[model samples]
Target: AELSRLLVLKPEILLLDEPTNHLDLPAIIWLENFLRTTKCTIILVSHDIEFLDKNITRIFDISQNTINDFKGNYSKYIIFREKEIERQIRQKKNQDRYIKQTNMLIDKFRYKKNKASFAQTLIKRLEKMEKIEIDAFDISSINFQFPPPLHCGKIIFQSKMLKKTFGENIVFHDLDLDIYNGDRIAFVGKNGCGKTTLTRIINGELECEGYFKKGEKVIINYFAQNQNELLDPNMTIIEYIESIPTEKSVSQLRGLLGSFLFSGDSIYKNIKVLSGGEKAR
Candidate 1:
């Protein structure tokens, strides 16, 4: 809907940041087609490699307080960047060697009256030469791993004759399903196709006429679409996180929060004033 509104204005330039976050596959494909066909220049910030490769002609990479421009897609930009870094490293080594030779010449001839002119000339040359400074390159890797799952029965969830409705509007009827352990399932359909409704019914958030049972030791962790709405507006970020039961010390908790990109005074920020992305974090 927002994309449609933006297109109606027919702007010459478009700026998008993480545009695919909540988009379905079909919607994403449609967006790709629309952007590819438009004459408008687009500047987008996305971590989606496939999307960038398909739509973008150029890349502006920001690193170490500098913007490096590349005349190609994401993959090509990466290759170009690596080669550029190697060239810069070689140039810096050569510059260092020239400066060292100039210093040596100045030091060895400074006292000799005949070579004093040569020493002064070298000093002037050294003073006028521009020194090359290398930017700090960060190659730190993040620690990312999922926790082990708890023990559970063979059957995770079993449902029969599941019927969910909101007043006279039926979401789904006579839905029978048996989800087993280690099973991977995806519910995909157009909007208002009972996906969310079915999940809500399964989670017991909404009442439905059905036979639903969970296996022994079954645990459910439900993440709502509007999860940010559930945050307490009165609580500061740190205070809110600390409310949860944990064995971690205060410093450990802060470290954990920093890993999530919440650091310094931002931890004291009230949940009410945080942006959508921040609150979602």
Candidate 2:
């Protein structure tokens, strides 16, 4: 509600750094839709892959002390980024051949007066040639893998005889469902059918007198999807993470954060200034 009011000014070129931080899924969706139609440019930094994918048109990627300019939305950026990397690799190969040839020629003829005659030209040639600019460091790499989640028996959670209704409208009634550990499902429905309400009920956040049971060893990490609301306009990334409880040593946290793809001075950055993608990462 507060953010909605704030956005009413329709600020242009919203320098949103992870604007979706504390927002719920619905709020995130609202932002996506708004940005899609909003005339202003949005410089979004977010780790919400899906949201960025759906809305953004440009990406300025800084890596290894150089900025990468890509000319489209995130999905297009992905396509072009891979191709650009390949292009850079090829450029390095070509640059290597140039350096090898130049060095060998210089070594072969450095001692003779006749060779010295051509040395000036050679020196000028080398000086004027473009320098090879390979990336200063390699981003980390490993085969992507998913961790084995704690295995529960057949049914992970169950809800029975669930019902919900607003003052004058019935959303759902007498619902029965069983969710298994390995099952991937989308709790989907049209707008205002209380799909989110069901999740809240199962999460025990809603007052439900009916049947709701949790299996053993359930570890729930609620990564609330509200990207826009999570942002504190004044907070930077490093400062914000320090405020949270972490088991990681500072160096360990730094290493882990690096793997998640943040780097350089990004650690010292404020949450408010970070893109949603950066924070999410």
Candidate 3:
């Protein structure tokens, strides 16, 4: 909705940061097309590799307190970055060798009275020489693993002749499917295709014209795309997590939050003050 509002303004330049956060696949596709055809200068900060590959024409990589501009998509920028790193390494090696040789000459001359003048000259030269420092590539990688799910029954859900419609617009008709335990499924289609609608119907959040059945011990934990919308803005991070019923201890909860990068004092921060990424976590 925010993206749509921004688009309607028809700004000559657009700046977006993680614009795809709550978007469904279809919405993302629409945005990709929109960006491709728009006559605006776009500046995007995104972690969506595929989206960046498809939409962006240039990249401004922030590293070592500098913005390195690359005239290409994310993939090309990656290639360029690797080559640049290699070049930097080579330059540093050469600079180190030169500095070492100069220092050795200075050291040899410093002791002799006759070479003292040359040593002073070399010392001055050394002082004037620009030192080369290698920027440390200390990139931190995040690893998150979900707890193994409980073993479910043979048939998790089965739907027959399922159909959904909003007024005159029909999303799906005569859809039949059998979902078993541990079955991974992904819904793909254009906007307003009723993917969410179908999920709601199956979850009993919405009524539908069809037959839907669930096996025994089938528990659904739905995480909406707009998950931040569900968070209590009035609650603090720790308080919000505590609000949910769990068997874990307070220390365990804190550890879990820490894994989400909400450590120490940050857990006390109010949900309203948290950024989009924090709220999402």
Candidate 4:
């Protein structure tokens, strides 16, 4: 609704932050098209790389206390940023080597009266030299991987004549679904189109007019779209993770959390204090 209002105004400049947060796939597609065709100058901040790639012509990357401008889309910016980082690394290495060599030369002649003047000259030049600084980048890979589920029958889930309704509004009706072991599936639809409703029904979180059965040893771990809301606000990140029935030790768990970019004291932060992204993580 807020986005709709913003679009209705047709401002000369549009500034959007995470505009696709609760938007459905179709709505996101529509937004992409609108952005592409709009004549307004837009400054968009989003984590949706695909959306940015399609809608944006330029990028203003804010990092390391600086804003760097890139002359293309997000995909192009990624490549350009990497090459730029590599160049900076090489330059810093060369500069470090030169500084080290100069220091050594100065030390070698500093005590000698004959070359004291030369040492002073070198010292002045070295003092005047600008030091190169490389931006710190975290290259740590995310180490999150679900543990393999216990062996189950081939038919993981089966549903027949499924129907769901909210009061008098029919969400979906006469739907049949079969989910087998090793089958990857995605449910996509417009907002309020029963995608999440169907998922909830399948997860046994909602009462539906349907025949649903789970195969033997079938364990469903549901991560809802609003999963963060289900978290215990009083619990710290480490405490919440520890509550899960896992065989991992404290150090191992800490390492796992670190892989998710929650290192050091961050794991001790209460869930209530975390940002949406951090809570999701």
Top model number, TM-score: 4
* Candidates in descending lDDT order: 4, 1, 3, 2
Number of the predicted model whose lDDT against the real structure is largest: 4
Candidate 1 per-residue lDDT, tens place, 1-281, comes to 99789989999999998898778889899999998999999989887999999999998887667887779999998787778778888999999999998899999999999999999999998899887766544443444355678999999889999888888998888989999999988889876788888787667687788898878988877888889999999999999999989888999888878877788999999999998878977
Model 1 TM-score, all chains together: 0.79
C-alpha local distance difference test of each model: 0.86, 0.72, 0.84, 0.89
**Model 2 Cα shift for residue 25 (angstroms):** 15
Reference-based lDDT, residue 267, model 4: 90
Worst 10 residues of 2 by lDDT: 136-145
Error of 2 at 27 (Å): 16
Provide the lowest-lDDT 10-residue window in model 4.
134-143
lDDT score at residue 246, model 4, on the 0-100 scale: 88
Which runs in model 3 stand beyond 4 Å of their true positions? 1-11, 16-39, 62-66, 82-138, 161-174
lDDT of 3: 0.84
lDDT of 2 by residue, 210-252 (tens): 6878777875555445545666757766566666797868776
Q: What's the alpha carbon RMSD for model 4?
A: 1.9
**Residue 87, candidate 4: alpha-carbon lDDT:** 94
